[model samples]
Target: MNGTLIFDGGCGFCTRSRNLLTRLDRHGRVGTVPFQEDGVEERTGLRPDQLAASVWWLDADGGRCGGAEAVNSALSAALGTRLPLLVYRLPGMGRLQEAVYRWVAANRYRFPGVTPWCQQHPAGCRPA
Candidate 1:
């Protein structure tokens, strides 16, 4: 269940989403980081634009998935079930998930979001 969830630090919506994920992750099995942080690209091998486009999940074993798939992975780990992943794999469900995720991502700013966590707690944002 251990993994890293990379997200957009500048986007309030993304930050809030990460916070929600943290709450659901009672076990703290998933670690989250903002892609804007220094060396994130080097550590994840993901470009800035790619990270900006969608959330990413990097499993402990080095496996990676982005967009809706990433969400599925994070949720599965947090909830301790593969239901999300299973549903996502169902026929036509993947496309539906992708479309919905893209829509939300595109209109994320419209939804209410808290201030970026890093801006509020700079010292705690970066990994030591």
Candidate 2:
């Protein structure tokens, strides 16, 4: 994989979304890793708060992109398409996209599909 998709392991929405994206990603350009994985912070240069707030993408050379932009770029690369990336960059859309991402991320645990394990660690979970 050329990119590593760093996301929250404790989030139902994030895990489900990553799975959905993986299936959509026929090109298999990216690999998924939870923010809690060993050495993740060292590898991605991300603080815990930063990792908790958004999904992030790390390039082979260690270049990093976070939040909605990271999501769009990872999807685009994985599918070998530009339309998704283009849509994410449409004029006046960035703010709205980021807002939605933030909302979903903050409230991910409330959604269904959350594993029992993820729910067990309330303190480990992101802002509910």
Candidate 3:
């Protein structure tokens, strides 16, 4: 489970985010798993809706970080630097980031190219 990111496989946005992370993870520090895939729920204990609400990161130390915390960690790891990491650790920053994340999550269906099935049945939509 170390350094793994369990994401909503059904969401186009999540797929694109995963791809961007993969490209930035030159040291192979990050691995991605789609929540809709077989065995993912069993392994992560996260239901599909939970995963859709936010990104989740399992660190090498076995600690779990979610929402904006996960995003900050992933970005810092991908960049191989500590500045962005520091920003995330700053007081109030994490909370602010999480707030923005929630707003975006709530409106993801409005984004172009979001599948019609996802728009019609958000909870039921699985990765295509």
Candidate 4:
């Protein structure tokens, strides 16, 4: 389960989530990448448009996941348990999760007190 987890670098919410993942992934099983970092697009083959649309998880097997599924994968791996079990079992959960992810992706900038940079370049903020 070695792969990179790519996230929106600029969003405050995203950064906080990354921090949580970092703490949980103390075993170094997961790698984190902020979409705004240099060469991220080239390394991951994910364009800015695509990165901005959803979070991405590139699995060790070369499989790619996006939106809530990606998030669930990352969380499950980091949690090392069945925390994401419900997401995997519920009927229609994948479609519903993707739809919710899309709505959030589209409206992320509207979050209160978001930085101007985040509003302008939602895909380019990389975690520090």
Candidate 5:
């Protein structure tokens, strides 16, 4: 596999993002797995708390990156371009991107799909 992305399955926003990633992955170079799945921790060598904290990308060469960096890596691979990765690595841009990602992740359940789903199925959704 070109790369593997691990994300929060219980998060609606994350799920929607994954769907978009799926569409962008025309060559199927990236694969996604919800962190909630069994064996994920063992496979990734990450603890449950760590997995739940951010989206993670595991590269083919045994490299791991999380949060906005993970997103950059996944997008770069899916679109078959280095633009996203390069942009993310720019001095201040990386910090800005990470801040935005954290903001979105913190308020994820306030979004459309998440709010409704969490309202109906509180136990199934992770806290925002």
Candidate 6:
């Protein structure tokens, strides 16, 4: 219960990214689930927007972090990476990175992970 890595399993890019992280994670620590799946919200107690807005990390202690911070956490937990954690803390990097992440989330359909149909009807595309 160290933490739970969450992603938009409905997104094509998110699915691919999860696959890559699973491969790179030598410790097998990159456990993830898409919030759109059944029972996920009840299980995680995360609000809907928390899942839709960005990738998230639900810490073992119940702390929540999303977007770039979540990425940093996943890497750190799964691969013990420290560089991104360090770089993100520099002066204005956090705010800038978060804004960029929001933009990417908003435009995810244009990326490789989503199809036009899925984007059009997100309700039907989640895991069964």
Question: Global lDDT of each model?
Answer: 0.87, 0.78, 0.71, 0.75, 0.85, 0.75
Candidate 3 lDDT trough over 10 residues, lowest sum? 112-121
Q: Which ten residues in a row have the lowest lDDT in candidate 6?
A: 113-122
Better of 2 and 6 by TM-score: 2
Task: Sum up the clashes in candidate 5.
Answer: 0
* lDDT computed for candidate 6: 0.75
Candidate 3 stretches with Cα past 4 Å from truth are: 113-128
Single out the weakest 10-residue window by summed lDDT for candidate 1.
Answer: 119-128
After TM-score superposition, the amount by which residue 70's alpha carbon in candidate 5 deviates from its true location, in angstroms, is: 0.3
Instruction: Write model 1 residue lDDT over 1-128, tens digit each, in one string.
Output: 67989987777888899999999999878899888777888999988789878899999999999999999999999888889999999999999999999999888878888998678767655542
In each prediction, how many residue pairs overlap at the backbone (N, C-alpha, C within less than 3 A)?
0, 0, 0, 3, 0, 2
Candidate 4: tens digits of C-alpha lDDT, residues 1-128: 66788887677667667778879986777787777777878877888889877889988888888888888888777777656846665898878888888887787756643343344555555543
**Better candidate number, 1 or 2, judged by lDDT:** 1
Worst 10 residues of 4 by lDDT: 112-121
Candidate ranking under lDDT, highest first, comes to: 1, 5, 2, 4, 6, 3
lDDT of 2 by residue, 27-124 (tens): 77888887866677787788988987888988777788888888887887788877777998899787788888878777887887655324555554
* TM-score leader: 1
Residue 47 Cα positional deviation in candidate 6, in Å, after optimal superposition? 1.4
lDDT of 4: 0.75
Task: Report the C-alpha displacement of residue 75, candidate 5, in angstroms.
Answer: 0.4
User: Tens-digit lDDT track for model 3 on 33-72?
Assistant: 7666566667777776676677788778868888877877
- How does candidate 3 score on lDDT? 0.71
Model 2 root mean square deviation, Cα atoms:
4.0
Candidate 2 regions with alpha-carbon error over 4 angstroms: 114-128
* Candidate 2, pairs of clashing residues: none
Backbone clashes in model 5, listed as residue pairs: none
TM-score of 1: 0.91
How many Å off is the CA of 103 in candidate 1?
A: 1.3
